[model samples]
Target: MSFEDEWAECQKTANQRSTRMQLNQTPDGNYRPGRAPGGDLVVHDNELGAIGNEAYGLYQHLRTQGDEARPATFAAATAMTSSSLSLGSALYQVHDNWSTQLGSLKEACAHISNHLDYSQKRHKEDEARIATGMHTVSKLYDYFK
Candidate 1:
């Protein structure tokens, strides 16, 4: 096909894709009620706290158990290296990679716990701010009475 034909076909495909209704959007391009203005983002405080606690527990477990093999693995690597065995290099590399991966996992667990905790605190602060604003507005109206 000519370049112009290909361009026209591409344009038609793009238009069709853009006009398709997405999961949270309606045919008229507005977000569905439960996902937008009228939606409730109700998160149970206890549930969020539980999740954060679970993440912290997992982090603690991994820190100890995951490193339980560290001494053995390093000892084996050192023995192999001192024996001038070709396997020494491979063992060391494995040890290094494993350490890196374990560190990443620990970091991820900690991040999850911290993020959840911060979210809970932020949500409570936002609620408090809104409540205070509403109370102030109510008092202003009463003063005018």
Candidate 2:
């Protein structure tokens, strides 16, 4: 009704709302053990493999096609320098920068691909180890029974 009343009401409402971080919690503010409502970190083998393959594919494509304009660009830059154009040095710098950036992008892609492949392999090994341990535990439990 009044400005002071509205301000007090807004403050009360804001104070009633939660401001704490709710990491891996359910909607009712309970902490779920295995998976929360937001879900757990799940990376399937096929998903990892697909991402790695895509990264590798991108790297391969960049390696083969990224430098297609290098020769022409350099030649043009050189010709411009020979013709006494002031922008020749800038053009050459641009070409160099482009090459550097392309190399960096290719390296990044390769790294992503390799890292994902390694992670996938490691995950499978871990799962296998866990399964073996579980099976051994079950056998021991049955023997005791």
The lDDT per prediction is 0.77, 0.82
Q: How far is 121's C-alpha from truth in model 1 (Å)?
A: 1.3
Which portions of model 2 miss their true places by more than 4 Å? 1-41, 137-145
Model 1 ranges off by over 4 Å: 1-37, 138-145
- Ten contiguous residues minimizing lDDT sum, candidate 1: 18-27
Least accurate stretch of 10 residues (summed lDDT) in model 2? 18-27
- TM-scores of all candidate predictions against the true structure: 0.66, 0.66
**What TM value does model 2 have?**
0.66
What is the per-residue lDDT of model 2 for residues 1-145, given as tens digits with 9 covering 90 to 100? Answer: 9999999999899777754434445668675544666654445778888999999999999999999998889999999999999888999998999999999999999999999999988866875686577568757756764
| Candidate 1 clashes between residue pairs 3 or more apart in a chain or in different chains | none
What does candidate 1's lDDT look like per residue over 52-138, in tens digits? 899899999999898888788889989999999889889888889889999999999899999999998998798678657756875
Which structure among the candidates has the greatest lDDT? 2
Report, for all candidates in order, the number of backbone clashes. Answer: 0, 0
Residue 24 CA displacement from its true place in model 1, Å: 21
